[model samples]
Target: MSIAIDFNHVVKKYGDQAVIPGLSIKVKEGEFFTLLGPSGCGKTTLLRMVAGFNSIEGGEIKFDEKVMNDVKPSKRNIGMVFQNYAIFPHLSVKKNIAFGLENRKTPKAEIERRVDEILRIVQIEKFKDRLPENLSGGQQQRVALARAIVINPDVLLMDEPLSNLDAKLRIELRNAIRKIQKEVGITTVYVTHDQEEAMAVSDRIAVMKDGYIQHAGTPQNIYHRPANLFVSSFIGRSNILNATLFATNDKTEIVIHDKHRVVLTNIRQELIKSTKTNVQVCVRPEEFLFTSDTNGLKGKVQRSSFLGLNTNYFIELESGETVEVIQESDIDTLIPEGSVVYLKLNQAKVNVFNEDGSVNLTEGVKNDAAGEVQSEVNNVAI
Candidate 1:
């Protein structure tokens, strides 16, 4: 059965260093929540705290209203899938999957029933008799998954389970994991350093930094409407251009290097003052469109490469800022390197950040009769 998990003002420390410093988060029942960050960013440490492998120094960690600060790991009744695919080489896939159930002192007939059901759920029934050494990496990982789920734990914790697999296997197994997770309806807390893995498999993701959550939202929100500069630059390939907001009589214009400017009709009211504070515009590489009109920003292609589905171009703007653009490969011809080009932003997906690294309150707004509100807002619930 699935259960909710909550972390309230949790704190963890290593000697004098604070690893996780007063972080509060909530994982709803049956939600596939992922903790994502670079190494040393405390994603793993947070997962370990949930699994009871690491203790919280300051606050409470509860599983469905049960205060588990003093609870032991074994009594947590949580199933964990590690990155190393900790299956016993001496045991067959079926036996490996049955280990958890056996340790729980479940009856023989019921263990068999659960092992068979879990193997089929992970699509590893064909390899049930094969040993871990006899199976491929993906197959071995499936066996490990079957083992974890066979016991029907209230929550499933995965710590970079797909990091050891190759690219092709990683994609295939992540898809399978997402499908199985939905079918099992287990409240899951997963940890990974991979952006694609986290974004592709998670129902919601908490992007972490310095043991604190930088942003928590759906993958689309984290990508399109990043809460701050670090999130915008980390979640995806973003070209952050320095721009200054100039207040005019009727509207605002974001001036770039004094020569190029985009009309900033939808901007936060506080920025409308005549004082010049630092501001930046975050645009994804795929959000730029090639245009022939000189009315847009002028740039020169520094380098160009044709990938399978898209051609990437590195363009140096007249302001000496480099912006990367990803164009579709179906174009009739490729723009040669050093070719002078004009580029314009789609604007709808653009995000603005203030000097203090907070998102501009009016970022991506669609102004009309209503006050400034984020455009393309979809399922903002974290």
Candidate 2:
């Protein structure tokens, strides 16, 4: 059966160092949730807390509806797949998979049936008699997974299970793991520092930084509507520019680098009302288009390189700041290095932020009328 996992105000400190501070999150029953962050950002620590391997300094962890603060690791009924694969070298695949069931003293016949069923599910039935040293890395990982799931634990925790495999094998095994998780309908919490892997497999992701959650949302939401400057820069590539806000009776205009001006039509009126007139603007690398017209900001192409699907250019603006732009590789007119070109930003693709780096603009709006309409809707809803 699936179970919900909850971390309520969890804090873990090692001696004088605090690894996780007041972390709180919920993983729904049968959901695939990931904790994504850089090394030492407490993602693994948080996963260990849920696995009952690490003790919390404060707050509570609950499985289903029961508080698990004092629950033994064995009694927590959770399966964990580690990065090292942890398969016993001396035991055959069949024995490794049935080890958990045997520890619970299941009948010999029942353990045999369950082991066979899991081996087939993981498509490793042909290797049932083989030892760990005889199988490939991917195959051994599958064996580890099969062993973890044979007991049918309420929750499954994986800590960078694909980090050891080659790139191609990593992709293959990642898809296989996601497929198995969906088929079994087990609540899962995966920890990884690879943003691409987290985005590809997680139902929802919590991006952590400095031992705290920076943002939490679906992959699409986190990528397109990041909550802060750190999230915008971390999840993907974005060009952040300093700007000054100039608000009129209806619209908010941002002056970039003292020369270029952009009208921000998506900012909330309440947020703009509190603005101190200076802000920052974030633009994704693909949002700018190169043109020959004299209307936009002029920049010299510092370097341009073809990278498979797209061409990447490092452009130096008139103010000496460098910005990156991505365009289709097959474009007829290429901006050569040292050539001056006009860079036009699509107003629809810009994100505005306050001085403190919080997102100030709602994602989409083309004009003041749309902003007013959204404001009215928000007011009515509230």
Candidate 3:
């Protein structure tokens, strides 16, 4: 059975410091939800509250329709996997997984059956008799997961469970966790600071800052259409160009760094309607194409680094502003440092931001640009 979680106006504080304040969110049944943020963002605190490990100062937490604010951790029926694989060194893998069932006073036959089932589910059954110290990091983590899920809890809470493993092992274990979750169809809430991990695994992510949520959406929406400046800068790499709104009767343009101007098509209509004082143009590194044509922005390459699949160049514009550009070409034909090049803005890929750094570009604008880029993709394919 899957569980849905609802957090309504929840608050947590330690004396005068508020870890979470008036926070509200809902995790759908059987969904793999993630709370993503930097350290000290209150993600772990919120997870603890849901597990009944932390007290809620205000509001309430609910599993399905039952209020959980006063519920004890044991009564919450939540299984938790922690960062450190908290397995007993003395106990073998089978005993570790069976500990939770033993605590609940499960029948001897039932406990053995369930423990064997979860061991097979996590694919670590071969090492059931081995002690934790004898198992690899990944093997031990699987044991920890088996221990948590053996009791068949309604909700599973994982607090950076992959943090202790090496990078390769982290990916391997995460994939295993996702596969098992799908097979069991259990409701899960995973908390992590690693952006790539969150992007790869989450059905939806809530990006938090300080004690509040900055934005909550699928990976695509959060990456492509961030709600604010903090989110735009946090989710991924972006080049923020300071610009001013220059509108004319027929069109609108932005004066970049007071030296150059770029015409805006679909974005112009919205900019002309806004009353904000400042504007910024956000361009990804891959959006700018290098051209030999004189009409584009003039820049001198300052440094270039080869990154296997792509070459990254640091280009200094005529106004002394530095920007990074990524190209998928060989380093042999590299634009050497101090070599002049022209950079053409792939206008369709650009995102405009208001003074507060909120993405002002609407879906209509994106669709129009996608229509234009569709032909470009086809031409490349041909």
Candidate 4:
């Protein structure tokens, strides 16, 4: 049966050096949860902790209601897939998948039945007779996947499983992995530094930095309403601009570059009550619209690149800052360099940060599993 996994105040150390100093998060049952961050951010360390490969120093790790702190790696009933395809070189594809069942002393007929079923599930029935060395990289990964899931593990832990494959194979295998995980209905914890891969397959993501979780939410939530400045810069490309927030009576507005004025309607009430004035604004490239009106941010296009569906423009603002803007490709003509353009921002979609850029002032940001607000915003019920 699939089970929910929980980490509460988990700590890890190497001699006297602390690596993960108390972390917490919950993975839902039968859900695909991803740990996303740059290297040395403790994503793989936390995954190992869950799999019983690394020892926990404090708090508790739980699979449903059972504490797993003292459990052995083999006793955890979990399957792990790594970046390097770790299949047996000597075993055929079918034999590799049937290894786990045979070790458990299953009936001979049952082992053959299960192996055939899993071969078909992973779509490697045709390659069952072939050895690992004879299969393609993609096919070898399928063998690894089939071997891991043929025993019906309670949970699946994958650490950068697709990081070794080429771009095209990565997409193909990721789609297959997601489909198979859903079909088998097993809870999964996946770790990767690739933001796009996390966003593509995860039901939810936990963005971590230096052993701390920066933000945890759906891909749409994290991309649209990031919890902090770091998360805003990490998830995707964005342009940061210095701005001033002024509240008078019941209205609040932000002034950018001492010229552009944007009225904010959905910001939290606490921000208006605070005495802060200076703020940072995060505007995505797609959020900027080229306007013909005179009352807009004036800029000159330096260069533009045509990227199939969208064209990217590098514009130099009058204040000497350069920003990237993306617009739909026009079949008519491309805007020439040195052409003066006015930009109007989509006020409703922009994220505003405080002076230190530590917390997001935008509303509807959700809290991580630790129940603490990573940003100064209203909690969104997920």
TM-scores vs. true structure, each candidate: 0.92, 0.90, 0.88, 0.96
Candidate 4: residue 311 lDDT (0-100): 99
Model 4 scores a TM of 0.96
Model 2, residue 18: C-alpha shift (Å): 3.2
Which candidate leads in TM-score? 4
Window of ten residues with lowest summed lDDT in model 4: 373-382
| Model 2 alpha-carbon drift over 4 Å, by segment | 274-276, 331-333, 358-360, 363-382
Model number with the top lDDT: 4
**By the TM-score metric, which is better: model 1 or model 4?**
4
What TM-score does candidate 3 get on C-alpha atoms?
0.88
Evaluate residue 96 in candidate 3 and report its C-alpha lDDT on the 0 to 100 scale. 97
- CA lDDT, every prediction? 0.83, 0.83, 0.81, 0.89
Taking the tens digit of each residue's C-alpha lDDT, what string does model 1 give over 267-340? 66654445455678888999999998888889999999899789999999998989999998975888889999
RMSD for all candidates, in order, please. 5.1, 5.4, 7.2, 2.5
Q: What's each prediction's clash count?
A: 0, 0, 0, 0
Model 1: ten consecutive residues of lowest lDDT: 367-376
Candidate 2, residues 1-382, lDDT tens digits: the string is: 9989877778899998888767777788999998888898999988988888898899889887899988889998889999999999999999999999999999999998989988888889999999999999999999999999999999999999999999999999998898889988999999998888988898988888877777777888778777667778888899988888887886777787776777767676665564347777888999888877776878899999888789999999988889999998885766679998888787776777777674445543221111222243334210
lDDT of 2: 0.83
Residue 35 miss distance in model 2 (angstroms): 0.5
